[model samples]
Target: MNKLLKTISVSVLGAAMLSPVLSTVVFAATAASEQQATRNLVQQLSNIKSFSANFEQTTKATAGTKPAQRTGLSAQHMNQTFVGEMKVERPGKFYWETKTPAKQTIVTSGKTVWIYDPDLQQAVRQTLDDQVANTPALLLSGNTAQIMQAYRVAQPDQSKTYYRLYPRVKDSAFQSLTISFGTNKAPNMMVLLDSLGQTTSIRFNNVKVNPSIPASVFNFTPPKGTDIINQ
Candidate 1:
């Protein structure tokens, strides 16, 4: 997986939303329908008992080159058993683990949100909201309040009923964000374009509504002797 995803603290992955297999793949909807559906799903997210899903992602599309592919698995419960895991085979094979409220991330070979390279030599730290925006977890988790607070939600082009997200705070990290509904009922995919026009796309699959998972999934304890640092 891309080491960068682990940065979402949702990599510990950035998440929220329904899965492709779960989503019906909506072709188009009336403007009002799109708006209402987006709003409805946003509300449904908060009420859903528990959720789980799998997804595929590709970062940096290059001409004549196959994009790096990744598989993501995530699950969240009412009390925050938020768990998202992503595996990417690229420059190398890597994994991302996240726990919320704190929304922490641990990366490969000594890098992370919880553990930084210059990370005071192996201590864990907390990530701020700006850092939080970079995660796929936030998108997948479907925390509309958090999403609405951080991004100015809009529909840029009327041709397609896609919901676009603009970072309200205005930072150098990303240029624009857009997410699409699979069947005008459930969220299926997210496309994030950074300042460089380089894009990261995540598609949700195998969604399990009202899942029967446990809260322990969201909790983590670092290896013994691993340093601890709090932001």
Candidate 2:
């Protein structure tokens, strides 16, 4: 459970150099532009009522960073990949199922979240409060105002639709988050960098925006004989 939680916190949540001797006026102008860009990004995310996508997630150590060792696998083999499906609805509801590398399902119904591991026949239930809602995992389904307050958004290239968000809080789960949008202005990819120097990249495929999703999709019930832990 500890391992799973760590993965969720780092891989799920998760930027930049500046020119020296830049003028104060230039700096002010840049800050104003970034603020506007942040608002625009927030609006784009707010417009999403429902989202569903097939995703490929890859995790690797940063260059020059030592990779953590795992049983039967050397540090050089630390890179891991997983394919998954994700669904989200506005106001705190989402479903994430990892299909390969390992099978795990995480679903939340506004008020509560459930993490299920089929192999272990275990399910962990957690309350979905403000703290949990602030995580990057729930970014699409969380409060936009809170998001705006928590991160400083920057769009390095106005020509491109990708935005990088730096956490305002020092103890944030990850170091930074980069979200990329397609030509249609739909999110297509996300990259998360953790403090431990691990990078997790998630690319979305067959993305659906504001689609009609059944409410049941956000609710999960452990099967018979499954051990349940509440947190």
Candidate 3:
């Protein structure tokens, strides 16, 4: 569940729209040109009110990293591919579901978050607090200025417009994040490198921008016999 949450946080961060506040303080180490480029990219996505897409996610351990012995799984088992669907509405509402390898659902109603695992008949509920708000998923849409301050942005590929971000904070969940946009300026793919040397890539398909997503999509009710954990 922890691993899943981390993946969702990074993936959703790439998919969510940035807030409209254009004045942001970039890292002092970043060049002025790169900062402006990053701001332009943010402005391009600020108009999106909602986003929905089908995604294919692949996670693999980087070479030289040993497989997780705690889980008693081989390197191949640790490397996985999943197909999922995601929906996001402005002001903090989202739904993410993984359909393959296992079925898991995560939904947030702007105030409360629910994570459900059908196979285990368990659900975890959490309140939206300051700590949670700082996560990549929420930060992307919550405050553009703050997110810019938190990460150093760079456009490594001028021709491809690849926006790469490195967290300035020490406790960041992932080491770095890279997002690639389609011709229409919609995010087509995102790659996340975690501290454990695991690389997770999510490719988006059939993306719908500013779609009329129903509010009910962000609401979740645990089924009967499910064990509920609150935090």
Error of 3 at 2 (Å): 3.2
lDDT of 3 by residue, 1-231 (tens): 444555521333222334579654433333236667678657755766788889887777768876552232245546678789988887778787999988889888789888899999999999977566555444434556666777787765444556777888898777888777777666778787777767777788999888898888989999999999998
Sort the predicted structures by TM-score, highest score first.
2, 3, 1
Comparing 2 and 3 on TM-score, the stronger one: 2
Off by over 4 Å in 3: 8-32, 68-77, 137-141
Give lDDT tens digits, candidate 1, residues 1-231: 122342120111222456678974444433434455456446644554345555554455324433232122222211232344433221111234433323334442212234433223455555434454345434444345666566655543444435666666665455566666544334466676654334666666665554555433343456666677776
Q: Candidate 2: what lDDT?
A: 0.74
Worst 10 residues of 3 by lDDT: 8-17
Model 1 TM: 0.53
For model 2, residues 1-231, the per-residue Cα lDDT tens digits are 222222321221112325576633322223227778887788788778888999877766778775343322335435777788999998788898988888989899899989899999999998887667766667878778888898888876655667878889898767888888886567888887767676667788999998999998997989999999999
lDDT of 3 at 175: 83
lDDT of each: 0.45, 0.74, 0.70
Clashes of each: 25, 0, 0
